[model samples]
Target chain A: MIGRLNHVAIAVLDMEEALKVYRDTLGGIVSDKVAQPDHGVSTVFVELPNTKIELLEPLGENSPINKFLERNTQGGIHHICYEVDDIIAARDQLVANGARILGDGEPKIGAHGKPVLFLHPKDFLGTLTELEQA
Target chain B: MIGRLNHVAIAVLDMEEALKVYRDTLGGIVSDKVAQPDHGVSTVFVELPNTKIELLEPLGENSPINKFLERNTQGGIHHICYEVDDIIAARDQLVANGARILGDGEPKIGAHGKPVLFLHPKDFLGTLTELEQA
Candidate 1:
């Protein structure tokens, strides 16, 4: 089952501009930018007291975030992440209940260095959802 | 400053269909439906372990959600709500920092009976953000 809300991900055209809002304006502590080459995105974490905001920028032409950016030129919320106590059990239950897991249905090491899986938007009221191991 | 992530709001075309995704598929405990004529939307909350998910359906033809649904027939994530310890202070700081506050720059009672105010999407990387008094 889902645990704490992990982090909300947002696609951004430019990370620096996005940081101006979350970091300078909102006073959130911004983490060092990390390049997630495997995922084809550059990520920055804006830490807050209870959770974090993840800013993602497409790193390559084939990046999934590129397609999302094409659809949303101004950038927008990409997905929400929730922590799961047991990801395998959660994935099995979700799959059994007819939820489509993205990318070979296997958990990948995410930005947090924890196993994560993405759920298809069609299966979750049009919202791309990410499940991360707690 | 933001306290905790209060909820993630999703705009749905049909409440019943959306419920099947969040409640039945994901095993979320859903709350009763409530209509907010003033906001022109019908809302239901699915309580999760860390936070809540709000499903919003357009109540009237001129509802703001109707406009969002017109572009995205399949529905999608709308906005994110963050809890703030002092909403007035948060609003003042944000306004002074050039963040545009939606409406008349005032907090209104939200679904949870907490004071809430929305921020412009343009200022926050196209993510419509709501700040709720914690």
Candidate 2:
């Protein structure tokens, strides 16, 4: 079951500009951009009191977010992550409920080094959802 | 300055379907649907430990989310609300930094009955942002 709202990931064309809005303009405590080549994105964390806003920029040519950026040129909210206690049990429950799991239907070590899986957007009201093990 | 991430609003075309995904599939604590006719939307809150997810459905003829639902079809992330200690000060800071405030540039009572202002998506990398007084 979903426990906490982990983070909201926003795919941006320009990380610097995104930082300006979330960090400079909004006065959030932002982390330095960190490249996650494995995940094919560069990430910047805007730390809020209760949660985090992750600003993502495509890292390479085949980055997953490149397609999202194509449709949303200026960038957009890519996905919302929820923390789950037991990911396997959660996935099974979701599968039983007719919700599709994305990729190979296996949990991958996510950016935060936690097991995570992506759920099909169509099953989630067009919102791309990520479930991370708490 | 942005303090907490108050909530993330997801606009959905079908409230029942959205509830099935959030409550039944994902096992989140969902609140009963409450129609905010003044705001032209019906809202359901998925209470998470850290924050909340607000599921919105068009309530009236001229619902604000109607256009968004038209474009997305299946619904999508509408906006993210961040809490601030002083909304006026936050507005001035954002305005000074060249962020455009939506509407008449004055804070209005949000769905939560707190002063809130929406920022232009163009100025926010396509992510509609709302700032509410904490």
Candidate 3:
């Protein structure tokens, strides 16, 4: 079931500039940044008062973030992450309710040491959804 | 400057079913429901720890959320709301940076005593962004 919102993902063209803007101009604080080579994207997290804004930039051509950035005219929110108590059950329930999963049926270690699985954006409106199980 | 996230909108087909599931099974509390006849849609907000899940159901033929639900196979995250200090300045800066605004250039009173404006999804990489000034 849905607990607290983990974070909101935003796809940006320049990670550094975006980070500076979000952090310095907007008064957001950088919580962390990770280079997800497997996904071919680099991400920076800026923590706000209530939520964190995730900045994702594509690392290569085949990267999904690259495609998203290529299609994006301005930096926009890409996905919303929900912290769930049970990832498998959530996935099953979502599938039963006609949602599609994006990863190998199992939860994998995500950017911040939590298990995460991405829900396919094609199946879920044009928005990507992620489930993080702590 | 930025304030709290107002709500996380989600597009759905059957408002009743989604409301039941989110309220009963997920332990989400339905804060309020409104039929925005002007916007040609009905929305219900389920409050959680930090944010609310907004369920949007299209009401008529030309509803924007209708097109969204049409494209969406499964209900997904629609837009992330960020409360801003000033709407005009934010709109100007975003436009200067090549972001697109969806509505006519004025802030309107939104669902919960807040002035809201919609930014074009096309400019934001298919991710609908909203700015709410309280």
Number of the predicted model whose TM-score against the real structure is largest: 2
Score residue B54 of candidate 3 by CA lDDT: 83
Better of 2 and 3 by TM-score: 2
Q: Write the residue-wise lDDT of candidate 1 on A26-88 in tens digits.
A: 777889988998989999987766788899998987888988898898899999998888999
Instruction: Determine the C-alpha RMSD for candidate 2 after optimal superposition of all C-alphas.
Output: 0.7
Measured by lDDT, the strongest candidate is 2
Q: Which candidate achieves the best DockQ against the true structure?
A: 2
**Cα lDDT tens digits for candidate 3, A1-134:** 78888888888877776765566545566866788887677888777667777788877778777665665556667788888898888888877876678867678887767889997765554557788994
lDDT of 3 by residue, B1-134 (tens): 65777788888877877766677545567866788877677889877788877888888888777666765656667787878888888877776766668868677777666778887765544467688985
- TM-score (chain A only) of candidate 3: 0.87
Q: Assess the local accuracy of residue B16 in candidate 1 as a C-alpha lDDT between 0 and 100.
A: 96
**Candidate 3 residue pairs in clash (backbone atoms < 3 Å):** none
Task: Write candidate 2's Cα lDDT for A82-125 as tens digits.
Answer: 99999999999899988999999999999999999999999999
Docking category for candidate 2? high
Candidate 1 residue runs with Cα over 4 Å from true position:
none
- Residue pairs in clash, model 2: none
Better of 1 and 2 by DockQ: 2
DockQ for the candidate 2 complex? 0.90
Sort every candidate by TM-score, greatest first: 2, 1, 3
In what order do the candidates fall by lDDT, top score first? 2, 1, 3
